[model samples]
Target: MESTREPAAPIAELDEDAAQLAALGYDYDTTFKRDMTFWGNVALGFTYLSPVVAVYTMFSVSLGQAGPPMFWSLAIAGLGQFFVALVFGEIVSNYPVAGGVYPWSRRLWGRKWAWMNGWVYIVAMFATIASVSYGAGPFLGTLFDAEAGVNTTVVCALVMLALALFFNLSGTRILNTAAMVGLICELGGAVVVGAWLLITARQHDVSVLFDAFGAGDGKSYFIAFSAAALIGIFQYYGFEACGDVAEEIKNPGRQIPKAMRWTIYIGGFAAMFIAFALILAVPNYEAVVADFNAGSTNDPLTMVLISAFGPIGYKFVVAIVLISFLSCLISLQAAVSRLTYSMSRDGILPFSKKLVRVNERTGVPSTALILAAVVPASIILLSLLLPDALVTIISFSSVGIYIAFQMVVLAALRARILGWKPAGSFRLRGWAFPVNILALAWGIIGITAIAWPRTPEAPWYVNYIVLLTALGVLGVGALYMWLKKPYLVGSAPSGDATSQINTIAARPREQVSR
Candidate 1:
């Protein structure tokens, strides 16, 4: 049968967009230009996740902890995060606000809860940018045949940060273009390298993937699996970047949710495929593990690449890896800046007025972009002071992001319990209850796995840094909120809860129509 439904008029769509923004306490004139298309949003999420980069960075660590069998944990983590993404999809479809969790939480719960969510998320994102840039150091060094020492790595990271900032400042068009190019390189590189290694140089037996090989401190296989799951947990999260830029996304209520889920689906497959190929291509898995245990150079993945593709091929692959890394940094900075801009627009953060100001020429949040680069660059300096700064920062980022994510999931569950129903096109319908519960449970497990002290023999600060940092962030955010309660409540547009809801409800029926 021929369809009779007519496409929504452009003016009607604009009115709907404006009404939705107003409901969230925003005006069209003050928000980001809705220039990000569906593919751009997908590219942003994919590049942020950066399967090839993430898998390469953490592959050796997972193998050292649980041998090749750790690949199974990636599958498990992907399943759990699938549900989490669904919950996030539903929220973004209805709200579709920038700042991802912060604004979502504010609408679901209250300002105080949203403030803390942003606090942890902002800290985690800064640490994430630092960690990702630092991880790129080795690959950059290999690509250029430079020494991958601490000073060299730090310098490389700074340079990458500068490039990311330049792209970010150039506006969404250039940034999205770079992201699309990165997506092609990332996926194409993964397929080429993975297929080459798997077909030409597989060294391990198929059954090796199920074998723990006694890697887990003489503990049970489950314990070893838990230890290895950290890589997957961290790798699966960059999909939320789609939501972080919701305001800039066209038809965000529908497209952003689909983009978020597709980010995970594609990213998870790419990560696993590359990891499996690398595992199969290892010439001497035992020696590689032993080198890792002995705290030797942390370039086992590079060695594997060299063995598989020879020197020239290795250099080419390293260049691809560098591209992935740079793209990841760019996506990270974009997400962080948007989040910062969203919070600032709500007058939650210090210097909100300045930070909320977008550059008219570039259509980018200039102050927020600068702040994003400065915070991560400053955090990167910790590499000079700490012996294991890279690992510490990675752990901090993983745990903090998981905590912030779980908070939103918990809020969703709370809203559901209070009879709050989602009106988004991507809603789970009756399935929301179970999905939210499962996602929350999975989040808690993921958080525990990341925070648990893997090595009791390590120094107190090293062993407990993730937990300590999380606590400290929460404490500081709570104190800030408490001290500035009056001002915070008065300054924000959404501060008047009753009026905000009433205003939204009073919007014209056509404007509020889905």
Candidate 2:
């Protein structure tokens, strides 16, 4: 008996999407399978912005630093990130290629500009992968009843990283499936857990959200609040991961922008909801702060769960949180690998030929995926040598990504100044300039906030770690660019949109999920 199968897509709609790619100076017959759907694309970014991982990791720091008042910072930082996301939406809508910032920068400005921007983004993403897996180590340690020390953490993180790479290199089907599972578990788990905590274990009233609890000096609370806002700043990113695999999504211009925006909306809401519930349920904020101030390894939310639901219950929640973390790891690796592939395909990175080769059966850049895992794995192992490794990596990941984002925003604003309107299905129209400017403002403040010296008492390098690491990464890249000039060597044409992006006219089954 013969089997039935739906068409991959309507001929004309496929033609229009292909035409846009061709006009952008790439072959339309891409080896990458257009296997991602609108929801799958959304899931990709949403899981990457995992609420469970963000809230569980940072809620304790914010609460410990600025007391309950830090709850409002989620909205503040999220607004800034949303502005940046809007700017990205405009760009990706017009140029929905792989490597979110790099390709867009290449077209908007030129190769050198894109190269440095891509370099910053690449480092940030790898740091994020390492930091996320490292963060998960503690929870995994808790779940397994292992000793709480650097050795256990590094081992757990490495195990998780290997598992993530396995899923990532498996194929697009497995990758998207892992992301969707992560989305369901994370968002669904957050709602259920938040509501349960709010209903059964509410120890403080909602008004507690206004109290700073003498976080800063008696003079002003600005410094402490700014430091606490890192929680939101860290949480709001990962939405840009949507555009990192544009070539793998059908009707990418339209799908990717919506996916990006939704990642911010839903991810922000989930983070805020969980944070609010955890804040109100804290049985003793003063003691939690004391423990955090004393440099304890245990997180406040974990303590709260143990109080509300005994050790066994806390262990159960740890299992759920571990799943969320693993899911996040999978998405981060996928996004970073796609970026490496995009950069290598343009001959911008070293070993371009190896990284650029897409696996014939999997339709993924398998070697690039391995490269992504390898770099972060080394970074994760730093948990052994540097006691403050996680914090430094977290700061770099947030600040580095924010800087890269603003670079793109600046490029877009510059392009607008030179009279290039967004040419895809989505456009900001008259609001384009205004939104672009707002995004730049937000990015600047954010980079400063995350990179600012929160730990002056610590060693100098540790205190100014974000700035130092970011500058160091860029310094090396600049020297390489000047000497090697890799950008001048690529035969693949740079993406300068010669005409308006070809719109994908309505076609049957265009929105079908693969």
Candidate 3:
């Protein structure tokens, strides 16, 4: 007869004796690895492209109508994200885990509040996945313009979500591998394209960057650019993804915190450089604007490339754009799954047990992956049934994610200002704290600006959807608080170590019955 015993985990040991001693009948033993390197952490942080997102959102809206100082808006948003990253770094230093912001908020606040944070965090997370998929679908379809079919867009969205889910469920090793590859592709692609643009730019066109005079329309540059800044926030969202994997990170208390700091500066600067280079390299601002206004989904960057470097350069930009979208998709998947797992482990949602399950072979939160993919897939399918439904939902997603981000930053600031200091960790000395406080303020301002009604002519449905999504998130938080009351109020240790123990116990079991 074939052996019934499964192979043991190479990097971990089963604490069967201890389990027996405690009379616990948990399925799996304590077995996992967390040795991610500095570079790996960098890869994880860089996989979320601020520049691509910044460009996409900036061009999508009428930011130029408001003013030409759009870059300043990006600068403001980047600065805001930078401060939030510092606050996050402090928290990660002391209690690094995959939960990232929500868990940190919980630790600083309390279990009940953490569950509320998780409700908002997870809802907003899946909403983000839907938004990205929705946003990318239109762009990608535009790339295929004349031949783009409705069925094609739907199919592509589903496929991308499925593949992302596979990468997520394949476990930590595959996730890290994908992160490294995606990061290289994204960083290298940005640098190469930016370099090409700079090398070939005529000095006259480059002069446009340093002009102090605003585009001087009726709109103030700050407000118009603030619209663009909304897009800028996209680029930095994934940098903290490494923090989500903190428990799986080697020496996370030190390395994860350092990774967060490094990610903020590097990701922020790189994104700014890309934006500057692309703007400078564009030979024809009129052409770039015309293409964007014409709704060409080939990427505004591709339009810039074609205008500057001809057909070949345009093709190169096209490839880079696709890679950028792919990297964003990968980073989003990892973040959503890890967050779902974290929330589940805390019993903040339904299917808590299932969502927290780690596959024996993969050591991934498989059920969480399924949930992430399914939710987005359903949203996409619903889009098919309702023509402009996905668009509204995508917009709602931005509102949700931005609000959640604001809360996390505010919570971090509250902790710091209330005399909570990071213990034995990487403190951002030398104006970092002051900068962080400013960033928090800017974050709040930006979110409020984006949420505000920009035009009287703007559709009424947008207002309704945004309002409804906010209420829904809050409602879920209330529901979770009621259901998970015991877990939050039980006075158990609520940090990485305890969570890790629960995660270990939740794994698949293969015991020696004798």
List lDDT for all candidates, in order: 0.81, 0.82, 0.61
Error of 2 at 66 (Å): 0.8
lDDT of 3 by residue, 1-514 (tens): 1111234333234343333211222222333346457777877777654356446544434333322345565676666777777767766665555667666766666666666666776776786676666656645665555356667777766776777777776667877787777766667776776777777764335456544233323455554454455556555566677788765665565676677767777667767776777666545555444544455544555456677768765655665666566666777777777777666665665767777776767766677778888888887787776545544564566666666666766666666666655552466656656866776676667556656554445477554555676787788678656765734542324532222233232122233112
Q: How well is each residue in 108-145 modelled by candidate 1, as lDDT tens digits?
A: 77788888988899999999999999888877776777
Candidate 3 residue 434 Cα shift, in angstroms, is: 3.7
Q: How many backbone clashes does candidate 2 have?
A: 0
RMSD (Å) of each candidate, 1 decimal:
5.6, 4.5, 6.8
Residue-pair clashes per prediction, in order, are 0, 0, 5
Off by over 4 Å in 1: 1-14, 490-514
* Sliding window of 10 residues with minimal summed lDDT for model 2: 505-514
Instruction: State in Å the error of residue 223, model 3.
Output: 3.5
TM-scores, all models, native as reference:
0.93, 0.93, 0.80
User: lDDT winner among the candidates?
Assistant: 2
Candidate 2, residue 201: the lDDT equals 90
